[model samples]
Target: MTPFLTAYLQRIGWTQTPDVSLETLRGLHLHHNGAIPFENIDVILPHEIDLSDEGIFQKLVVARRGGYCFEQNGLFERVLKEVGFTVRSLLGRVIIADPPDMPPRTHRILLIQLAGEPWIADVGFGGQSLTAPIRLQEGIEQATPHGLYRLQRNGDDWILQFRHHERWQSMYQFEMGQQYQADFVMGNFHTAHWPTSHFRHHLLMSRHLPDGVKQTLTNFHFTQWQHGQVQESQTFADVAALYEALQTRFGLGVSDARHGFSLQQLEAVMAGFAQHDEKA
Candidate 1:
């Protein structure tokens, strides 16, 4: 059996070497976000989601498939452990549409111990999550290309806050406690295959750059955000166009069976978003 650590370093685009440092960690995060992509195509494809080390290694390192939170963070933690970093799987809830509500168990994250303090290192969150590890403490802000971020304690759990428009907004909540890999397997399966899950109902991919730029695709529209401004927005009319963009622009490759959203479906979804915006 290949050592889990070796497999993880390869998965993150690093060859097995003795030189590991904080800079290496940062480079790994940047390399992952740039190369692997943050995509939910497996969800729409209804593909089998696996949380095992070997399974994740094959999909990410061998097949070069991109995945959502559980797949991304799950594999990332394995690599950190292999590199002598103390790693623990944690659960988080996204606060995109709601505020201050307890999120579901589906959200998976990592608590990494380095330099005698635990830090948050997440590679799975689609957009605007910390692109590098941030120290887990209260009242201290860590600046990144995306924005200024800080972790605040709320009783037993923690809230990740992002500075936007000169104010802090709660991005997500996570607990520092231990979470088993099997716990995420059920969630991974549910998000990938369940009809009611949002991942199953939509097509989405996103990535954050080191310069604080973000590229995102939802349904048919592609958007690029730079320096807090939307630098580009384009809508494609066919699956071929979307697939081409995925390959050429995003560096993602997957089986054609994963393609599910057509132009018509994407248009309908965009229309729903327009209606929601109008109502708001």
Candidate 2:
């Protein structure tokens, strides 16, 4: 195996795999989601989100930091290609978006054709990331370690939904198109710097446990889910508590090199959230 692939395997707590099979894909997806959380700290810090290959590897694997969809799925895509898998870069329009009526394709997803069958894999949808790759079948309720997800047909596009609170909530919509790093670069720029982007407004981090439990932190609100139910939740009273949860709970340590932020800056952002809440 190549050195890059070797280090990536080690980062995700996986030994070397012999081949690119369905079982291997599932195992990698599960392990990757658990170890690397989905977070938007850079967006909140207003730092430049480097989407280059070397940049992503350094920020996520070496620095031990979490990132949003672009970095997370982008890394996964590179890994799968290195492992001899047929991977295609795809984008999705987030359903929960600012312009709720029609949103841009800011979500990065992968489509892999294995054994003559196509499957979707995404390790970066924040609170609702898929823990396993499901086949490209419409109306089939695919079960992951955390929840039941399915894809549906919508006029030439595909909509992904997860069974939340006994309701199939739509996550995003997509139409198969060839996407390159250049495409992601433009999307990442808008997502990171756009004034109205949701990533700028709130702090979001998510990770799933090996035992089918999901933990998500949305600003001060932290929630854990098990068996598709809310297992535990809490609201942090201050930035100190929030910072602690990012390290201890989500495995993201916010030192200068790791997360590129200090506690004082984090406190300032939390104060902004409070002010925004008051105005609402």
Instruction: Evaluate all candidate structures by whole-model CA lDDT and list the values in order.
Output: 0.73, 0.87
For each of the candidates, give the backbone clash count.
0, 0
Model 1 pairs whose backbones collide = none
Best by lDDT: 2
User: Candidate 2: which pairs clash?
Assistant: none
| Candidate 2 global Cα RMSD | 1.8
TM-score of model 2 (CA atoms): 0.94
What lDDT does model 2 reach? 0.87
Indicate the worst ten consecutive residues by lDDT in candidate 1. 254-263
Per-model TM-score versus the true fold: 0.84, 0.94
